[model samples]
Target: MSRVLVTGAASGLGEALAAAFEARGDEVLRTDVSYEGGVETGASAPSSTHGTFRLDITSDDDWAAALAHVEATWGGLDVLVNNAGVAGGGRLDVATMDEWQWITEINLFGAVRGTRTFVPMLKRQRSGRIVNTASLAGLVHPAGMASYNASKAAVVALTETTGHELAAYGVTAHVVCPSYFRTNLTSSMRGADTELAGVVSHLVESSPISAADIAAAVLEGLDRGDELIVPDQPARDAHGLKQSDRATYDLVMRAQAAKLEGAPRG
Candidate 1:
């Protein structure tokens, strides 16, 4: 079985992914920020996970420890899933610098840190995969998701560049962009806009799909060797538009935003 490490594995999307990997018989290391309450685990967390460790994704020292642990236990890692993220609602005009930094530190830099940590091992193996979780907002740019959108968009770019750079080493990198799905990120989001929070929460809760579904899509994407994995249908459509049509895509999104109650008008 391949050795796999999944960040943010205590709950929600990360937990779902960890469970899926475990079920597939891979040796899984589930990592997350150790909360005062406990390590977050989803209802479907698998009993077969190899181990769980405390990992603050934004900290370089924590990532070093995680890699060291992997080296001690498994000798090498076959898959690294950079799935940890935090959402922050933003009204750009009024958003503070600290708000941007908070979101960027975890959402974008967290993935970059994970990728950088694992690349050496992956390159040595000459056969491994890296999956970075992004979002549909990265592609479509929803009105109120300024910080989140920017971070995820950066993840997309980072993953793509890694994929290209690692091609010669036979190590593949992928970015997963999923649309609205139930995730703990909603509860953990930081922002002052209650209305933005309410809207985001509504969209998340209203999603017919669960984190498990997104995990399944991710596995499928891995099997297919897709570099850019758009897990949900909405994300797939949005990504398709970005890939196929630029002008019409932005125009449509802007039109939709025009109807938003609090959105800025043209």
Candidate 2:
């Protein structure tokens, strides 16, 4: 069985992913930034997990401690799932620089810190997998989501580079670009006062799929050895449209942008 580590596991997709892996008999280290003070860093509490630790992805010390725990406890890790992120976006003219930094730090740099911390051990072992959770926004950029789009897109690029860079060491890297599904991700949404944020929240809340469904699809994708896994039909269709019919894609995107422009700002 694989020894897996998942960040942002307190709830939502990360929680579902940890459970999915554990259900398959893999030992999982479930972690979240919110799980602090009550549980010591690297210490497992009696939650629904093989182990649960408090890991603030923004902190390098947390990353170092996680690496140490894996080394001392599991000997090494087989899969590192960088799934921690926040939801935030606005128009280029509307989003503040600070808001962009906040989302980027957690959404993009969090994955980077996790990957950077674990690569040495994975390289030493000569076998490992890196799974990064991006978003459909990364692949198909919609209007008024420049910050979120850029962050997730960067994750896709990072995963691609990591895959190519570590291929010789038998390490595989994958990036999950899932469309919106029913999850608590919107709870962490920043700039809730904005119209764009409201639209994103509506889409997420109204999705037919659940976090478990996406988690299952992700596991299936991993089993199939997919490098870029777009786990939902709508996402696949959107991306396919973008590739096969750029003019149509442009029209659709521009239409959405036009709608956004016409709407009253919250």
Question: Which candidate achieves the best lDDT against the true structure?
Answer: 2
TM-scores, each model vs. reference: 0.91, 0.96
Off by over 4 Å in 1: 35-46, 244-247, 261-266
Tens-digit lDDT track of model 2 for 1-266: 99999999989999999989988889888889887642343334443545788899999999998888888888999999999999998888778899899999999999999999999999999999999999999999999889999999999999999999999999999999999999999899886337887888899999999999999999999999999999999999999999999999999999999999887665
- Candidate 1 positional error at 203, Å: 0.4
Model 1 residue 238 CA deviation in Å: 2.5
- Winning model by TM-score: 2
User: Which parts of model 2 are misplaced by more than 4 Å?
Assistant: 37-49
Model 2 clash pairs are none
Please write out the lDDT profile of model 1 over residues 1-266, one tens digit for every residue: 88989999878999899889888899888888863322333433346367677899999998998889898888899999999998886666656789899999999999999999989998998989999998887676877678889999999999989989999999999989899998777988777656677778898999998999999999999999998888889878877887899988888877756655464321
- Overall local distance difference test of candidate 2: 0.91
